[model samples]
Target: MRVLRKRMDKPAHLGGVLRDALKASSLDVDLDLYRLWEQWTDLVGPVIAQNARPAAIKGKLLLVNVSSAPWMQQLQYLKSEMMEKLNSALEREAVKDIRFKIGPIE
Candidate 1:
């Protein structure tokens, strides 16, 4: 009679495994963008956050949906400030510019 043994491999850290998976799926950037969206209220404060919502991120540009045209116009004036705030909150230059359009907030 013969006995066989199975080999075991070293375990990878959870963070490293998650990083690898995100990279493999090209989801790292998407995840970061989603984080920005998720943290919109916390980053921009309740007033702005209530009037506008992050719609998408294309390259360094951020698309925002504003509740009304007046709000969109107001946000346009605060574009640079908003960008700085969001980037500061993210601890990275995730968003460079913001484009606001009048659209449904919810």
Candidate 2:
């Protein structure tokens, strides 16, 4: 009983303890989206930068802000392809659809 009590008092490994705590939280979906947000610019860069941002309502969706009507038309034409590329890069079909809107005057 003395030995067991002494062992229980040992300090926990910080890394492992933290991992276990995070796992217990069970917020994987939220975490995944956060990670994707951090990597958005790097992952899609020019393709999406200044064009889109992720928005969560009923489900995951991308809100695209286009510079002009022509650009909007171009993006509208490639909506499905863009969704495929984004979801593929994230390794999960997180984005269910894309919503395009005209950007505010610059």
Candidate 3:
């Protein structure tokens, strides 16, 4: 007669496992971008959120679409502040700079 034994492994939290997978797959930045889009209003506040929206992220630069030229101009003055807020929320320096373009948000 022979006996067989099975090995058991500890389970990891789903969020942490997904985050690790993203980091390993080099899609961590994409997750960060998704977070930015998902939490834009809470991250930046309703006013900025209403006038500006994240369009894309290239390297450390963040491209934003503003509702109007005046809003774009206004956002220009708040670039550094916004970067600080974004990076703080992301828990990393994923967004280093911002460029605003006049465009429809949708």
TM-score of 2: 0.52
Error of model 1, residue 6, in angstroms: 28
Residue range with the least summed lDDT across 10 consecutive positions in model 2: 49-58
Q: Rate the local accuracy (lDDT) of all candidates.
A: 0.84, 0.66, 0.87
| Residues 1-106, model 2: lDDT tens digits | 4455444667789998876886566464556567656676776566655665544322566665666677678777888887787778768786788777777522
Rank by lDDT, descending? Answer: 3, 1, 2
Let me know the TM-score candidate 3 reaches against the reference structure.
0.75
lDDT of 1 by residue, 9-95 (tens): 987799988979986764766876788888889988899989998887777788899999899888888989889988897778878
What TM-score does candidate 1 reach?
0.73
Residue 73 lDDT, candidate 2, scale 0-100 = 82
Instruction: Provide TM-scores for the models.
Output: 0.73, 0.52, 0.75
Compared with the true structure, what per-residue lDDT tens digits does model 3 show for residues 8-68?
A: 4977799998878887764876777788999899988999899889988877888899999
